[model samples]
Structures are given as C-alpha cells and as structure tokens.
Target: MDYDVFDLGDVRLQSGITLPDAKLAYKTYGRLNAGKSNAIVYPTWYSGQHYDNEWLIGEGMALDPSTYFIIIPNMLGNGLSSSPSTTPPPHDRARFPHVTMYDNVQMQHRLVTERFGVERLELVTGWSMGAGQTYQWAVSHPDMVRRILPFCGSAKTSLHNIVFLEGVKGALTADAAWDNGWYREQPGVGLRALARVYAGWGFSQQFYRERIYEREPLGYGSLEDFLVGFWEGLFIKRDADNLLAMLWTWQNADVGRTPGFDGVAEALAAIRAPAIVMPAEQDLYFPPEDSEWEVAHMPDAELRVIPGAWGHFAGGGLNPVDTKFIDDALKELLAKDV
Candidate 1:
C-alpha cells in the first residue's frame, strides 16, 4: 500500500454504534519540524483519496512539502479508510455505520496528535466535504488549528444541499442491480444515473452554454461524450456502497452539531482562528451567499468568492486559473501570524 494505516481499534461512533478494528488510511508529505509546529492538516474531500489531494501540493505551491509537513487523512468511507468495501462483514457494505464529519475529524485528531506528536496545526484546509472537516476541526479543537481556508464548502449542509443529495441517492437506489446495497457485482446502471444527477449540480449552466468541455483541457466533442467519458467514468471506478456511505457523511455535516455548541452560529463564533472562506460564485449548491453568512458569524474570517463559471469544480483543481486563485489565497493566509 502507498499509504500507512493507523489502527484505531474498536471506535465508538457518534451514532452510538461501535466500529470494530477501525483504521485511518493516510499519507504524509515532507518532514515535521523539530518543534512540530509546521504541521498542516489537509483532509480529503467526498469521493477523494490522498492522491487526489496532491494537485494542491507541490514543491513551491502554498502547500509546498519542503516548507511544511502535510497530512492527508482519508475520510472513513472513501474505500481506503475503514470503508464499506474494505471493512469485513457485519459492518461491511450496507451495514457500514453512519459516519459524521465530527467522527471524521475526531479520528483525524487522533492521527495528528497520537501518531505524529503534533500539538498545533499551522493550517487546516480543504474543499467540499473536506472543507466541512476543516470547519469541524476549527470548532472541535479551536486552540489547535491556527488558521483555516475552506473552499467551495460550508460549515453546515444547507437544506437545499441535503435535498440535492437525496436526488443523487434516489438515482443510485432506484437501480434494481443495487439490491439494497447488497449487490454481488458493481451496480453500473445506478452509478451512471447518480453521475447524471451529479452532472447538473457539479458545474454552472454557463459552463455548458459556453461549451467549455469541448475546449483544450477537457476536450470532449459533445455533451454526451462529456457525460459518458467524464461523469460516468468518474463514478464507475467507485464502489456503489462506498459512495452511498460517504454521501451520508456529506448530507449530515454540521459543525454546530458538535457537543456544547447550540447551533451553527454559535459554532462559527467559537472558531478562534483566522479564516478565509472561499465560495465559487456560480456554484449551484455552495453559493457565495452561504459563505457570506458563515463569514459574518466568524470572529476572524473574510469571504473570498472564486470568480468563475466552473462551479463547484472551480475548487476541484481542474482549471489552472481557479487553482492559482485558491493557491494565492492560501499563500496569503499562511503568511499571517496567528
């Protein structure tokens, strides 16, 4: 395996169920300074693994390995971590316990502190559900995280976001091949349907109107080609059960749900770190408006809207321009003394 596993033994989840012999799959970049003060935690996003996060890390980028120690911890149901596909029976497949963003960050805290002997995080950042974990880390252990940069994500899953996820869930479950998640083989039909449902919300209408997919980097001749080649192709490699498991985590994410915080506002108020909340202006689900409210409640945060029609994928690192915008913001945030 390219990554290392931190055996968590039997973990009692927030849902009150015990996950037997739980493990966290992670990969580290660079070295922890002698003071262990240069550590940065960059958790994985929905349907993303450690390697998928590498696009934001390189020799001279804001996440440069040479200047800081970076840790990418896979979310629980992302296949590599104690996911439905990897876990043994009983808690495997359809029986995988519901994992919340709180559960994810808690385990990540264990990995960061117990495994690495790190006391303070220089920065905690991510995109999408990974951003949700970023907020969770800031709220759950505010003293430990010095700074945060959450892009194309939110501190709470909006009602509309939850409904959108329902449509994605329904598409997958509608397939007879799914067999209520007990499929003996991959549920190709459901996976494709899910991808189709996702395609609508993943990007802006302007992106389609402009036919950006036909251009250089994407290079698809037609919409069908883009749908089949890009959308379907992406989901086809992922396990149906694993996708659904992570979907549950995404739909239910809320930093306020953490104990002691009454609601999202209170949780946002509790974050003591400097933050840069970046939302894609054209993102259908995670709009800049939602980010505005989050920034309003934060003690030390500013809203920076990503100006583009790439929608949520604007922060997905496909477009070099958007990537540079995000990277530049991170560079500025890291330069600040917190």
Candidate 2:
C-alpha cells in the first residue's frame, strides 16, 4: 500500500478527453544506483495494484530489489490510481474518460523522467494488462527502454480477447444493480457473474480436471464453494465501474491503432528493444501463438512459453513450475546486452 503520486497537471487521453488533475500512483523498491541504469519498471496487472506485484520483487528474485531499483506503477482504473472510485467531480465513475495503453505508457514515461530522473529503463516487464503496457513502452519509446519481458499478454488485443472482454462487460452490465455503472451499492450479482466467467477462462482445463482448486491459496470443499468463495471473493473488494474501465482498456489494447500506425507490422517493427515474450501454454485468453505471431513481426524479440497447466493464471505464478519459468526467463533476459 506504500505509494507516491505524480501530478501531471491537465492530462489529455487518446480519446481526446482531458482530466484537469491527472495523477499516477506508484510504489518504488530498492534504491536507484549512482549510475541510474539499474532501474526496472514493472506495471501492475488488471485489477491489481502495487502490492499485488510484490511477489516478484523480493530478494534473489529476477527483479531483486537488492540488484535493481524496481518501480511498480498502478495502471489507470485499478482503483488505487486515478480511477472511477477515486476521481473527483465530472471525471468520476461512469464519466471517467477512456484511457488506452498508449496513454498509460506516456504517463508512466513522465513519472519516471520527471519524478525520478530516469531517462532510460534497464528493463520493463509485467503480466496480463501490465504486459500489454510493456509492449506499448517498447514501441512508443524503444530507445529509452533497454529490454521488455511481457508475460501472458499480446502487443495487440486479439479478436478472441475482445470477445472474452465483451463477455465480462455483458456480465457486469446485465446486473439490475449495475444501474449503468453508477450503482449506489456495489453490483453484487453482476460481480459474482463476472468472477464466474473469469474462472472459466483464467485457468486451464487441466487445472479443473485435477481439481486444483482444492489446493493451496484457493482450497474449497466443493465446486460450488470454489466458485462462490474464491471467484466472488476476488472481485467483491473492487468497484464495478473501475473493473469496467480496466476491461475496456483491455479490450481495446492495440499498439498499431493507438498511435496511428499503418498496420500491426509497422507497430511491431518499430520496437528496437530486445523483447522476451512469455505466454502461458494453456492460456486461453492470451494464447502463446498470438505472442509468437506478434514477435515474428518485431525487429528483435523472442517467444518463451511458460510451461504449465495453470493457463493465464500461470503468469500470476500460482504454481511452482510457472514461478521457476518466470524467474529463469527474467534472469536470462536481464543478462543479455542491449
């Protein structure tokens, strides 16, 4: 929960909507070296805040704070940042303007340069929506970023990803309590439904077949108990409007269209940083093949699939095998010369 805010005055988004007081919330770990070249920027995932990324930031980890200065920025609409729940006046709730991955990267660039005097990053890495932002960073400011490690995410939101997001949006909006995203009370029924939908897509079929829900971190007695207790519990603390804002951002995540590139190839080819894309093998939402296709178009990129049966949740390092895969990939990525 330790965080600092960077005020960028009036910030205008890609959608041409302006918020008078725009701020980014972030948390920093370790100390910046005298050389200032040891900085690593790790953005948070969907519905995740600074603390959620702490698992990858401890001692002996790939992003060990002792070896590198790590900055974890909470993406917009993640509740802790300038989100629906925290924004004021006209920009609050449903009125909050649309923010694209481009906007998030641009704002993060400002945060690093203006607040921390970090002109270049040693590494930019993240998972899920955070990984999407990592791709944006490499394309938007290639020279300023040394390397990128995007796990379980694509440079562009695939058609399948858009459809999946639409399902989430539909579930949220279908609740009578949603009330057009400005509900007086939290949309309990809709949130539960949204959680249920995520459960199906977030984990692999093998995970369910083996009844992995009966294990650590999410142990439940029955199938019904797992759905209600685990899935519902995850989304209940979040604001529905905030989740919707993130979902929309996730749906429209496309680097090619963001800055008006001629095509996807042009966007991918623009990146000069060495990128290591680690997609989970069983991740239905962000399949490994999508990353493989995107990486093929990039000037310098490598595809590394996290081998596990946990699907998209593998990027969260829920399983030991996936955690080792992440750690090994990151270590190798950082060791390379850029």
The backbone clash count of each candidate, in order, is: 0, 0
The estimated TM-scores of all candidates read 0.99, 0.97
lDDT of 2 by residue, 50-115 (tens): 998887777888898899999998999999878988899889999988989999999999999888
Roughly what TM-score does model 1 have, to 2 decimal places? 0.99
- Each candidate's lDDT (Cα)? 0.95, 0.90
Off by over 4 Å in 1: none
| Cα RMSD of predicted structure 2 | 1.2
Candidate with maximal lDDT: 1
Q: For residues 1-338, what per-residue lDDT tens digits would candidate 1 score against the true structure?
A: 89999999999999999999999999999999999999999999889899999999998899999999999999999999999999998999999999999999999999999999998999999999989999999999999999999999999999999999999999999999999889999999999999999999999999999999999778999999999999999898999999999999999999989989999999999999999999999999998999999999999999999998899999998899999999999999999987
RMSD of each: 0.7, 1.2
Pick out the ten consecutive residues of candidate 1 with the lowest summed lDDT.
Answer: 212-221
For model 2, the superposed segments whose C-alpha errors exceed 4 Å read: none
